[model samples]
Target: MYKVDKDLLAIQEARIHIEGAKEAAIELRNFTQEELDVVVNKMAIAIKPHLEELAKQAVEETHYGLCQDKLLKNRFACEYLPQQLANQRYVGVIKENYEQKTVEIGVPIGVIVAMIPATSPVSTTIHNAFIAIKSGNPIIFSPHPRAQKTIQRTVKLLKEAAIVAGLPEDGINYMQLVSSTSTNELMNHEETALTLVTGIPKLLPKLKAANKPFIYGGSGNGPVFIERTCNIQQAIHDIIESRTFDNGIVSAAEQSIVLDGPIVEQAKSELTRQGAHFLSEEEAMKLVNVLMKKNGDLNPESVGCSACELAKKAGIQVLPTTKIFIYEQAYVSENNPFAQELFSPILALFVEPNWQEACEKCIELLMEGAKSHTLVIHSNDEHVIREFSIKKPVARVLVNTPSTLGGMGATTNLFPSMTLGSTSLGIVQASDNISPEHLVRIRKVGYGVRTLNDCFNESGNQSLHSKDTQESIEVILRKIINEMKE
Candidate 1:
């Protein structure tokens, strides 16, 4: 009997994992929409009540993010996400008219590999699992090493629930023993029908080479402008919560605060009240010199570290209650590292002479890695909000809300999402919240001449049944206004 080398055994194990997923996907394709809905509802119910507990476990395991914030993210997925898909028909011949043959169908894309980040572990898993289940596709979750325990436990519960709901036993799986070697192989594997990767910005280059249809996580370097007319105190509070929640680890969290001249002082005062420590101008300049390269690059170490951490390293004492540490600088200088996405409670505050200057600075940051990230603005002036919303390249734009909570659909009415898409990079083409509905693809059926005519007569202009013409009028007016501005 030939001995089996350990390396060869690992490869074989990966093969088995991939094969199991493939088989599950095929089995899922044979299921009815009713069966898929049962799986969806069952999984949602299974995870709903345990959100708070799971958040605690996640923070303990990953050592990132606040338990309370994670709790909000988890509950959002459990209650809202499923509810969004609840009444929607995922699998069916959606027919405008059966005889006319105007129909659309939902088709499952076999197996998917969802890569969960350490920052938002359990929440990502829950979201991915729910989406996969709703779309009638089998999924394998690959958690970042920092969050293995939490991810493993959740996946275990979800799998069991799916089985109990009469779904295939292997409908959902997890890589209990995941590593770079395994993940690289899994992404490149021919069977991974779709891949959802969320991690370091550097990982995108590798994912791009995988030759598979994938959705990537957005960078956290979102920029926001606080126009002078904005409610300075309210904007400041919102910024603090968004930037510091979970210690600034959310990938979609705001990075830099571009403050308009008139409100800079007021904004700073409000931020101070909310536990933010602003650096004196001299200290800010010194920190900028030390943290930035002569060519304007942000030092690599400063990317995700808090200001207090940076200050301590620079041989200075930082205040204890400093929820956010600030660096005051004239502008992004060459060799200064201001364009990076720092996943911490540090924010770069740039004081602009006017709205034009603020807009320019915000644009520069977005050009760095924020293609699909978020941009926030605070202004009561409709013109300011309108101009910025139309001109800014980032995906989501929040008006009069804190950048973080507002973008996440928390304090404001925006849809809750941990993952923000950057449309600029073409990775995410929209500003809408990232949801499981994204996992589905539609198929359409067309009608023949005779059938079309018969249906038109039977329906008798049913398209005219809409409530009002107000929405259409608004669209036309907005378009006209945008063109006139141009």
Candidate 2:
């Protein structure tokens, strides 16, 4: 009897998916915008019915988030995303400038290799597949090992629905054998046009080393600042709801809270009323060990754990109504674990003297833990809101809204997406909420309205603008084409 090497088998599986998707991509290029839209509509309709099963399976397997919240994520991808992408055009002759004699065509970026996160695997998979098909590109997935079952099930359903609606057989698929070696094969393949990554922070270095272009939706340590003028009740409500949703596993959830000094006492009262459990000094210290690993990275075990669960793990008892865990800190520093993104229903509180100091504190938190991700400001003052908007270096700034819902477009008008393209972390080239539009390249068409001499001779020499001074356009074109052939 003979046994095959698992790494070699995984690598072989990676090649099969890529090769199949490459062939499907060629067929996809001929699809009209109407045809693509029909396919997406069918996928959404088909997947909507299975959201609950997939959500439950995801929670049971990964044990990372609540089933209900996960179901909402599924609905967002299947129902909300399609409506958002409904009227979008991504095919030939997208735009034209009559006066300039130019046109723009939307061309697919070819086959893509995408990595799915364990945290939001099902939703991200569904969303990535839909957008890839809408833009006329076939995609392959490297499912996170922990969520492989859910992801594979999703791909199976998506592929079936897509094929029934005229997508090529391999238009959407996932790796049955997932390994780091196989994932690299997909990313570095010559036929793979782009790599889409989600929630894989540890793979940043490897992603950078790859030769292909990638779009990464990585970690966020987005903080919420409650200014003096903000509605205390509303601000605290949104913060708790957002942070506690899905046990705070979503990357866009608030990591900390900064309060304007004048409202310190009042805000603390509101936070407590809203189910926030402000920890004692000893309790905070215990959770610090549970939340942060010895290497300064997030502790895997604590992720997606509720406040009550995390408290029990840390050897502390908390009220059953506790929705979030808050630790008050006097200073912000790189050495502080609370300054980092904990990825749980845990938050650090900082009080500042004024908007200027609060802004500085938020900036310090971002510099230490996040890059181009998200930030939230709760205030009714127009000037203060404008000031923070002007000074912050983030992708999306949510004002008077919950960070999670607003960032993912649940309660905002931004595009509905599963991938929040966090920039400045590594090789990701885009900062938009990942969508079909980002997966296509724009091709420009020009009619040569003027001669090169018209541009080159603007400094004094007479151009070929007049008939008498012009070389025949046909003759010039023939000469250039003949030279190129030679």
Candidate 3:
């Protein structure tokens, strides 16, 4: 007897799950928002007891990040996330606009195909599952092969909890047979409505080729700019805390630091006092060799490693208390490994002549890696803050806060999410944090607010003149003519 190919078997398994999820999604649509919230709350409660164990498993399996931080991430997802969702309406009649004479109903976007990253397997899985069910959608996760066991275990626990709380057994599922072929099949499946993926850039092309609507969370090499008017101590502390959190595995963590010339010395003193070790030129080159491959991709081994660990690996001795590794540089470019996202407790520092130059440098660093993701500005001056906020290309401009925590909503009002959208600027479909609302379609009910003739007549009745419009037009025309003549 001939055996079936493993890839084919994986594809078949994905199809089976997709069909079941499609059926389950239909059932989920019948559930009220309250019922869905009950299921979510129960799942969160059930997962609470296993948070530490799951974190431990993830660390042991993936060998990335710290278990302590992973535990916090898990709790944030299962606890803080549910709290944030408690008051939000995701299903049925979610919004009614009396003024506009329109009502909005929430409709699930069928089955969701989620691709879990190894760097954040358990928490991401839990977060995705809760949001999917909360929005009346069924999700099937394609767990990273390196993190399959931990992800599967977490999924199993959540599935049990969901079923116990009246959710369909197939509402939450994962690929038992994990492979790239299976993931592709799941993404391209006919039953799949949307794909929510957060991972490295290598998988982006395949996701795009799937020919389905998808929300992608791409790479972030967010830069932190310390303007002259900022609180030097607070700014340095926030950057250190954020960049060292989870050993810098978080995409929104600062990859480079752009300091205003006036505050450079104070910032450096504070950074050094906070346990930042500045690497010498030779040592920096050693780390670059270790952290980056010849093809320009980050080395998986170096990702999520602590500063001391990375230093040891690079054959450089450093104080065991080192919280961050710094490389002083004068420029940003695609070829500069230090300017790219390292995914470790490593930062590149650049000193600029002024805030304007610092802003330009920040933009250059973002362009090199993190476009339309996140940026942080440390400044007390409202004018400078507003200027940076408006000029930066990043989606979220964190103000005087740790980028990792602020971007993830731990320290800000932003939506709590494991998957962050990069928006159209990064060639991603969504720009906001991935939430239950993103997994559903909004159906608008309009009650004849106005007729077509009414719209046309109202527009025609409006007087165009406002504060000397004729004079303004004449001034603009005269200026144009004068410039042409000149």
Give the alpha carbon lDDT tens digit for every residue of 1-486 in model 2: 899899999999999989999999999989999999999999889889899999999999998989999999999999888988888898777899999899999999999988999999889999999899999999998999999999999999988888899999988888999898998899889999999998788777888888568998868888889999989999999999999889999998998999999999999998888898889989988998898888877788888888999988899888889999888999988888887777799899999999999998888877775565889999999999999888887777899999999999999998898899885766676886888888999999999865566653454356467664455555667898999999
Worst 10 residues of 1 by lDDT: 451-460
Instruction: Give lDDT tens digits, candidate 1, residues 111-207.
Output: 8888888777887788788878878888888778778889988888888899999888778988866667677777888998777766556568777
Q: Score residue 325 of candidate 3 by CA lDDT.
A: 92
lDDT scores for all predictions?
A: 0.74, 0.88, 0.87
TM-score against native, each model: 0.83, 0.92, 0.92
Q: Using alpha carbons, what is the TM-score of model 3? A: 0.92
For model 2, the superposed segments whose C-alpha errors exceed 4 Å read 450-486
By summed lDDT, the worst window of 10 consecutive residues in model 3 runs over 455-464
Give per-residue CA lDDT, model 3, range 118-237, as digits (tens): 988998999999999999999998899889999999999999999999998899998999988898899888889988888656778887787778888757878898888888888888
In angstroms, the error of model 3 at 312 is 1.0
- Model 2: lowest-lDDT 10 consecutive positions: 454-463
**Local lDDT at 481 for model 2:** 100
lDDT of candidate model 2 versus the reference: 0.88
